[model samples]
Target: MGRILLIGGIGAGKTSIKQMLMNEQVSYQKTQMLDFSHVFIDCPGEYLEIPRFYHVLIDASHQVSEIWALQDATKERSFYPPKFSKVFRKPVIGIITKVDLPKANIKRASSFLNYAGIEEPFYTTSVMNKDGVAPLRMRLRELNELYND
Candidate 1:
């Protein structure tokens, strides 16, 4: 099983993506523990809580294969908070969520990526519209295949 870490600021649609993947309703009270699948761990926690929680998982059997940065494109460059980059050495992919939102600018999206020091291509996704999930899934599956190889 591949462990996918969903990291982002509050209200960046992490839960929406998780719900889309699971095909179930998103609820904090119900899924506080963790959601398991062939592809994800679905640990949907705020920025502060993630560090401590991730360290505990350090001694666990699974290692995080990918880190998905669920970013809000409409937000300013300063809005992208600093993350603990030392946590993982694997691939970290930036995902610009809420693509269906009106007034979404691609320039801001690129700026956000530059500010985050990410050079890889990011997905402009809207879980509400289902525009970008398929390509992302294919990319993720490719990553999983590479990891196994």
Candidate 2:
């Protein structure tokens, strides 16, 4: 929790989740750049979508403490490749965003994260409804404490 970076495809709720955790208003403004705060880094989804931008994240990895490889439970296509987590030395947490969506598929999200080699105990969250946000925040705090210790 030194500085958590949220990485995922667009419309996957990274900004919403960040706002939820920050207790800020949930507006629909799209993140057009690599926006980050003192505590959170909300990466643009296009970086992950475009092959050339992978290096950007890889380079940016040096600035963050951990990575949240998020997936939209409501979306269909799997975006991550197998063992993708190996590219990062930082701890990777698999997050299934938009869990409150009508079409959420938790299993499929988890499957893709697992295939990507993300660590166990993946989290499911819905920023709008505040579902599963508290526990994740608590866990981040715990991780922060551990990092400090």
Candidate 3:
């Protein structure tokens, strides 16, 4: 399968999602640098929060087939600027994480993603409940098949 890169602000559940997808034990741990595996490229949130580190992400994007832009559903503000996804040439998928939280506002999160230049069909997920993870796995499988040939 082609590598999928995950990027977002800190505590957006990027690491947790990667762990779950890899069938590893999910735990809270801060990502200090770029992490690579056979199927995913897990980026540290600092890369997105700090402007100077943007080049790091753009450079890394070339190694992956697609990008997953994550947004914490409960966050009051977004780290991404307008049309942020346009910087990468690969396909960008929008994901709203921690949707199971009572404070999560899906509509607001969707708006943030839209402002970041992500289109329709956002995926909502909660690692605690494993909600909305299956479809992502299926999508990844489809991507693998589509690009493997």
Colliding pairs, model 1: none
Ranking by TM-score: 3, 2, 1
Off by over 4 Å in 2: none
Instruction: Provide the lDDT at 66 for model 3.
Output: 94
Provide the TM-score for each candidate, comma-separated.
0.71, 0.93, 0.97
Question: How does model 3 fare in lDDT?
Answer: 0.94
Which stretches of model 1 miss by more than 4 angstroms? Answer: 25-38, 48-62, 77-87, 147-149
lDDT of 3 by residue, 66-148 (tens): 99999999999999999999999999999999999999999999999999999989999999999999999998888889888
Q: Which of the two candidates, 1 or 2, achieves a greater TM-score against the reference? A: 2
Which rank order by lDDT, best down to worst? 3, 2, 1
Better of 1 and 3 by TM-score: 3
Candidate 1 lDDT, 24-131, residue by residue in tens: 765444235455566666544544245556554332224567767667766554344344433457566788887787867766876666566665578888877787
**Tens-digit lDDT string for candidate 2 (58-96):** 877777888988999988887777787889889899999
At residue 96, candidate 1 shows an lDDT of 88
For each candidate in the order shown, give its overall lDDT on alpha carbons.
Answer: 0.63, 0.85, 0.94
Q: Which of candidates 2 and 3 reaches a greater lDDT?
A: 3
